[model samples]
Target: MTASPAFERLAIVGIGLIGSSLARAVRAEGLARTIVCADANADHAARAKAIGIVDEATTDPAEAAAGADLVMLCVPIGAYADVARTIGPALKPGAIVTDVGSVKQAVIDAVAPHLPEGVHLVPGHPVAGTEKSGPDAGFAALFPGRWCILTPVPGADEGATRKVADLWRACGMTVERMDPGHHDRVLAITSHLPHLIAYTIVGTATDLEEHLRQEVIKYSASGFRDFTRIAGSDPTMWRDVFLNNREAVLDCLQRFTEDLTALQRSIRRGEGDALFDLFTRTREIRKGVLDARQA
Candidate 1:
C-alpha cells in the first residue's frame, strides 16, 4: 500500500526561486496531499498555478494559510512580521509553521509571537539556491545533495520539529538541528559575509571609469565572474538578509577587515612567504569543501 502523505495541506508563501522549488520537491516526493502558494506578486502566484506546481495560488497569505497543515514562509525576512500578522489569525491550531529564511533568530522573533496557541514554529534554512528567481527558475532537483538546517526555539514541539526535518529529508536534503542564535552566527561567516564581499566587489567594478569598467567586463576572469554571479542574487531578499543579520554580519566584516589589513601590510613589506602561506591555507579549505562534497 502507498504510504499516506506527510501533511494534508501545505501552503507556501512567496513563489520565488526557493518557494517554487520547495513546491516542486514536495509534489515530486508526495509529501503533501494539497499544495498552494501565496505571493505578493499576483503574477508570480498565477504563474505558479499555471505551471501546475500548486493546486491554488493567491495574493493573500491569510487565504493560502487558512486550514493548512503546514505553512512554509519563503518571503523576504523584512516582510516576515507583516506576513505573520496577516496569516496568524487564519492559521489553524496544530498547524506547523516553518520558514526558509537564512537568519533564524530574527525569523522566530518576527513569526513566533503571531502564532496562536498549539501552533508550532520551526525556523529552517535550506542552505541552497541559485542566482535565479521566479517560478520558472525552480526545479525539484535543487534540494538534492544540499543541507537543510532547522532551528526550533526552546519549548517548541518536538514532533513538529521532527516532521519539518523529515519533510526536508524527503526532498533529499541532509538535516541538522541548530540553536537559532548560533545558526545566525555560523551563517554570517559562511553565507552572509561572502555575499557581502561579492556585492562590494561588483559595486566597485561598476563604479570604475566607463572604459575601465567595459574592459573589466570584457576580460573578466573566473573569480570576478563568480563575484558577479553572487551579486546577481535577488536584491530585496539580500538587502533584508544583511539588515536582519547586521550584528553577526558586522562582526564578521570587522574580522575580515583586520585580516585584509594584515595582508595589505605584508604585500607592502614584500613578504612573499606571508602571501604564500595564506594562499596555501585557503587552498586547503577549498579542498576540504570538495572533500565534503559541498563544493
Candidate 2:
C-alpha cells in the first residue's frame, strides 16, 4: 500500500536544478500529493510537465501557489522578493513557504514582508547541487546523504517547521535549523567563497593568450579542471548569490585574501617548511570533510 503524502500540494517556483530535483525527490518518496512547478521561462515549465516531474507547470507564480500547502522558491536569490510579492495573495492560510536559495538572511529579508500574515515563512537551503541547470538536470538521488538547513523566523509555527523538516528527511536528507544570518555567514565560507575563487581562477585562464588557453584546456585534468567545473555553474544564480550575500561573502573573501597573501609571501621567500606545514594542515581539513562525507 502507498503511504500518505506529507504535503497536500507542493508549489515549486523556478524549476531549475534544485527545484526539479525537489520535485523528483518528493515524487520518489511520495512526500507531496501534487507537485506544481512554476518557472518564468516557459520552456522550463513546459519541459517539466513533459518530463512528468510535476503534475502541473505554469508561468504564473501566483497561479501555481494558490492552493499549495507548501511553496518552495527555487529561483535565484535576486528573484526572491519579486516571487514573494507575486505569490503573496495567492498563498492560502497556514501555508508553509520555504526556499532552496543558498543565501538565507537575504531570502528572509526579501521574502518575509510580502507573505500574508497567516502564511508561515521557513527558509531552507539544501546544501547539495551540481554545476548544472534546467529541468532536465535534476534527479531524486541529489537529496540523499545531503544536508538541508532551515532558517525559520522567530515565533515560527513549530508544526510547520516540523512538517518541512519531515519532507526533507523523507527525501533522505539530514535536517538542521539555524538563524538565517549565521547560515549566510557559514555558507559564505563553506560554499560562496569557494565558488568565487573558482570563478576568478577560471576567468583568469580565459584571459590567457589564445595558445596558452588551448593548452590549459588540453591539459586541464589537474586542479584547473575542477575550478572550471565550479565556475560553470548557473551564471544568473551565482551573480544573485554574490549580490545578495555580499556582507558575508566579502568578510570571508577578506580573510581568504590575507591567507592567500601569506602563502604568496612564503612561496616568494622559498619558505618550504611553512608551505609544507600549511599544506599538511589543509590536507587534514580535507580528510575531515571526507570523513563527514561532505566533500
Candidate 3:
C-alpha cells in the first residue's frame, strides 16, 4: 500500500485494454497524482472517463500529454509514430515517454526521433494480457506477478527508466531490463509465433466445409479452443505486431516450418519412436515453461 513517487500527471494515449489497465493500476496503487487517457475512439475515451478509471480522458493525444510528467503510448504499433509526432511538442521538459508495445525496436524507432531534448524514451512490454480488448476489458489485476520488460535505448535517462520500472513494480510486476533486439527475438518465439500459428490454424478451420466447420467448433474443447482464444485477440493489434516484427517472426516461422516438416515426415513413415521422442521433448519444454511461471 506504499504510495509511488508522485508525478504531476501521467498521460496514456490509447484507452484500450492495456491503456485502461494501466490507468486502473496507477489509480489503485497511487502511482501518479493524476491519470489522463486519450483514445481515437470517442466512445472509448468517454467510457474510460465514465468508469472513473482515469482522472481525465480526451480524444486528442496532444491534449492528454500536455504538461504530463509521464506519457505512455499504448496504441497499436502502427500508430506509434503518428501518436508520437502528435504528442511530441506538447510534452513537458524532462518528461518520460514510454510505451506498452509488444515490439520494442519498432517502438523505439517510431518515437525516439520526435521526442524533444531532455525527454526520455523507455520502451516496455507487459507480458500479460487476455485476448479481449477495449477499455471495459481491463482490470487492475492484469499486471500483478507479470513480467514487465523495459528496453531503454542507449542515452535514455536512467532516472526515467527506474521510475517506470518502479511504477510497474508497484503494480506487482517484476521488472526486467533487456536489449531491444534481444527482447524482440525472444518475443518473436514466445508470443508472436504462437499467435501466428493460432491465427493460421483458426483461419484454416474456418475454410472447411460447413458441416466440418460446425463439428470443429463443437469438438474444439480438447486444444483447438486454446488456439481460438489466441486467434480471438484484437485483429488490429495482432496485424500491427506481425507487420512491425516482420523479420523476427519470419525467422521463427522458417524454423517452425522446418521442424513441422520433420514431424510430418516421421508421421508419414510411421516412425513411432521419433514421434514419441519429439512429443516427450516438447512436453518437457512445457514443464519448463510452467516451472518458470511463464506459461
Candidate 4:
C-alpha cells in the first residue's frame, strides 16, 4: 500500500515567494493531503490558488489555519505576533506551527505565547531564496541542495520537530538543528550583514549625482551589479529582519567597521603586505565555500 502523506492539512500564511514556493514543494513531494494559503494581499492569495499550487486560498489567517495539522508562517518577522494571535484560536490541539523567518529568537518571542497549549512551535529558517518576491516567483526547486535550520525551544515536542525536519528533507533540504541565539548570530554575519552592506552600497549609488548615477549603472562592474541584485530584495522583509535581529547585526557591523578602518589604514600607509595577507585569508574562506558546494 502507498504510504500516507505526512500532514493531513498544511496551511501557509503569506503567499509570497517563500510561501508559494513551499506550497509548490509540498505538492510536488506529496507531503500533505491538502494545501491552503492565506495572504494579507488578496491578489497574492488569489494568484496562489489560480496557479493551482494550493487547494484553497484566503485573506484570513484563521480560516486557512483551521484544522491544519501543519501551519507554516511565511510572513515578515514583524507580522509574526499578529498572525499567531489571529490563528491561535483556529489551530487545533497538537498542530505544529513553524516559520521560515531568518531571525529565530525574535520569532519564538513573538509566536510562542500566542500559541495555544499542545500546539507545537518549531521555528525554522530555510536558508535559501533569491532577490525575488510575490507568488509568481516561487518554484519547487528552490530548496534542493540548500540548508534548513530548525531552532526548537527547550522542552519542545521532539515528534513535532522531527516531522518539520522530515518536511524539509522531503523538499530536498539538508536539515540541521541549532540553538536560536546561535542561529541568529551565524546568520547575522553570513546573511544579515551582507544584505546590510549591499543595501548601503546601493543606497549610496542612488544618492550620487544624476549624471554620475547614470554612468555608474551604464558601466556597472560585476560587483556593483551583484550588490544591486541583493539590494533589490523586498524592502519590507529586510527591514523586519534588520530590526528584529538588531543586536546581532549591530555587533557584526561594529566588527566589520573596525576591520574596514584597519583596511583603510593599511591602504593609506601603503602597506601592500597587510592588504595581501587579508586578501589571502578571505580568499581561503571563499575557497572553503566552493569546496563545500555552497558557492
Model 3: colliding residue pairs: none
Candidate 2 lDDT by residue in tens digits, 1-295: 1867878899999999999999998888888889998999999999999999999999999999999999999999899999999999999999999999999988889999999989999899889999999999999999999999999989999999999999899889999999999999999999999999999999999999999999999999977999999999999999999999999999999999999999999999999999999989999999999999987
- Per-prediction TM-score: 0.98, 0.98, 0.98, 0.99
lDDT of 1 by residue, 59-133 (tens): 999999999999999999999999999999999999999999999988988988898999999999999999998
Write the number of the candidate with greater lDDT, choosing between 2 and 4.
4
Write down the lDDT of every candidate, Cα atoms only: 0.95, 0.94, 0.93, 0.96
- List the candidates ranked by lDDT, beginning with the highest: 4, 1, 2, 3
RMSD of each: 0.9, 0.9, 1.1, 0.9
Tens digit of lDDT per residue, candidate 3, span 86-154?
999998899999999999999999999999998899999999999999999999899998999999998
Residue 228 accuracy (lDDT) in model 3: 98
Those runs of model 3 whose alpha carbons end farther than 4 Å from true positions after fitting are 1-5
Indicate the TM-score of model 2: 0.98
Q: After superposition, how far is residue 84 of candidate 3 from its true place, in Å?
A: 0.6
Specify the poorest-scoring 10-residue window by lDDT in model 3. Answer: 1-10
TM-score: the better of candidates 2 and 3: 2
